[model samples]
Target: MLVAIGACYLDTILTTPYYPGEDEKLRATNVTRRRGGNCPNTLEVLQQLTSHESTDEELPLALITILPAKSSITSQQIRSAFRSRVNLDHCIYRDGFEEPASCYIIKSKSTGSRTIVNYNDLPEMSLEEFTGIANELGPKATWVHFEGRTPEMTLQFVRYLRKQFPSIQVSVEIEKPGRPGLQELAEEADVVFYAKTWAQNLGYRTAEECLREQSTRTHEASLLCCTWGQDGACALERGTEDFKHVAAYTTENFQVVDPIGAGDTFIAGMLYALNCKRKDWDLSKRLAFANRVAGMKVSQEGFKGLDRALLSFG
Candidate 1:
């Protein structure tokens, strides 16, 4: 089973001609509403990729996420949006709260680049609650992915998972900056994925350089990876100074309708490959496979065409 833990939000995406000027009103070329978050996006793609892998038994998936305590329209939308196979019984609903929402403005006619304005007022998963779920999933869990929310709590939870279930692979996405204990989580994770823009903000010039620097610091992780939009993705293992770069599959003949969740899709592809194939793949081949999957993602919008995208890969 692949277990994902993090925040889930209702995302409203708007496609505009160009970024608006200060206090200037503009009309959107297109609009889409969906459930989007690091964990959910990864989980959705993973589900699509692994759905038909075997016929004997179902590949189980469980998503541990936060939601509103009271059943509201947004919460209902999230519930309806999840794939039928995803187990959502473990979701924690915040008392008397509404789900957080994010708005993305994509300059579709110009650069296809996006600007995200989000409201994250929901409470984070508590350490005790996290431990409870981990204990239940100890035997059946094959992989667990986390979004770095409360860093200190996340570190403690990951450490407990390592001590209790050493065989299960643990991966963390560290896109958010300035959170305490993030480095500690990186140190404990089996795999770490960093966002290119976030890494650049920390004074790194490129994703390869970021991977090299992070590879030196992580004591536990053997694989350190990063994603660069349009520039493709790169990775380096522990004790390796050189990075293996995978070129992004071009969208030359296709339109990039929405590129919002491509990174999460890439991570999901990587995890699916690693779980099914283990170490049979080299770093570059694994990265290349993920690159292809992400390329398939951007060629379409949202997760609507994801199944077709994965099948096209076959």
Candidate 2:
């Protein structure tokens, strides 16, 4: 079982032909509502890529997210949104919080960028609560992924998890730049994922440059990956400073239909590549495979058919 820790958000997405100017009135072409968040989106994509796509019994993909009260309609919607592949049996539901955290997204057709505004009144998960969930997972879990948020609490949980479950491999995503203590968290994770936003925020102009220069900041044995949209991704094996880069996959007449969750999709694909059944691939090949998966994601509307990302590789 691979356990993921993060929030469960109700995402309201609006697609417009172009980014709206300040005070401009432009009606959106489409409006969609769905269950979203880093953990859910990644696990959902991973579930789709597996051979047993309909059940978690063969390959358990579980989420440890905080949701609204179990009785709320929003919570029910979030729970029922995913297919049977993702196990939600270990969710934490707050009694007093009836409304789920919301993410309002504006996707522009012309720019291929998603502008997001988030509103969350729900209380953050405490370290104690996460420990309880970890205890429940016990010896069943093989890998645990953490979304970088509530950095202080997450940091504590990561350390605690390492001490408690020394056999379980840990992976952490460093997506947001403003969050403190992520640097420390990065040092502890076996694999660390860095978004372009996170990289660029630190004055990095390219993914390769980021890995080459920032390699010393993390632990010696940690593997670091930095994903730069369109240009593809670069990774570094920290111990040996073994760096590799893979270009973005694209076909003739390629088009980007939707960019939402592309990073999360990349994370899922990378996780699938490194931790899934196919483990003999080299660093470059793994990045290439993940690049294809993520590239395929942006070429379509949503996560459907991402399993086909393995077609050329297979």
Candidate 3:
């Protein structure tokens, strides 16, 4: 089993400029809405990739995300969005909160570039809340991924899991650099994943530089991965003789509808392949599979039509 921890949100996306200034507004050329956020999006991809194995296999992936607050229409939409992919047995529904977190995304019609505005209503999960569920899933989980939205809570969860199951691998996705006490968490992680942008934000010129600096300074992490959009991804393992670079796959000339969740999908594909014990040389195959899913997502209006594309990847 693999566990992902972070926020889940309802995403509203517009493909054209909705407004230029306070007085001027523009109509969108395209629009989309979907269930999004770090954990949910990543887990949805993992679930899609892992859920159809033979019954003799271990239980499929599990997620530990907070459900939307009671009585919110967004909650219903969120539940419905992931109904097919997630098991619901591992989900937690909070009673008194007013609304779930949400993201408003704007994409440039010509460039496929996007900007996001987010609103979060779910508070960080307490240690007690996580440990109860971790105890149930820990023994089964081979790997756990954490997106740094709730670093303090995530660190506590990692600590508990390490104490309970020392062998289980923990991967941390560092979305931002300035989170308080994040370095401490990075030192404890087995793998640290970051996008090229995040690596740049940390004052490193390249991913290799970032990983080398982190490995030298902390010495606790084993692996560091940096993803470069369309360029490829690179990984450096501590105590290894050299770095490994996996080039991005070439796709048939196709249009990009939305690149919003491409990175998350790529991570999911990588995790799926890794967990399934696929060859490292096949990493590009997994990335290509993810890119295909992301391409299909953009061509459509929402995240609803991905089941076929995601499952079609062998």
Instruction: List lDDT for all candidates, in order.
Output: 0.81, 0.85, 0.71
Q: What tens-digit string does per-residue lDDT give for candidate 1 at 1-314?
A: 88999888778788888888889899997888788888899888888877867764446788999888647777778888887879888888787786555544454568778888778777788888988888877789888888887878888888888889889888998887666677778888989999876788788888988887788778889798899887889988775654689888775686676688898998988987787645566677778878888888888777755655456554
Q: What is the TM-score of each candidate against the true structure?
A: 0.92, 0.95, 0.85
Badly placed stretches (over 4 Å) of model 3 are: 17-23, 57-59, 70-72, 83-85, 278-314
Which RMSD does model 1 reach against the true structure? 2.2
Off by over 4 Å in 2: 52-58
Between candidates 1 and 3, name the one with more favorable lDDT.
1
- Which digits, one per residue and each the tens of the lDDT, describe model 2 over residues 1-314? 88889988889999999999999999999999888899998988898877634344356788988888999999899888888878899998989988898999999988888899998888888888888888888889998999998878888988887889888888999999767887788878888889988888889899988887767777633678888987888889887778888888799999988888888888898888777644478777778877888898889987888888777675
Pairs with backbone N, CA or C atoms under 3 Å apart (clashes), candidate 3: 258-298
**lDDT, residue 1, candidate 3:** 71
Output the TM-score of candidate 2: 0.95
The model with the greatest TM-score is 2
Candidate 1 shows a clash count of 0
Report how far off residue 84 is in candidate 3 (Å): 4.8
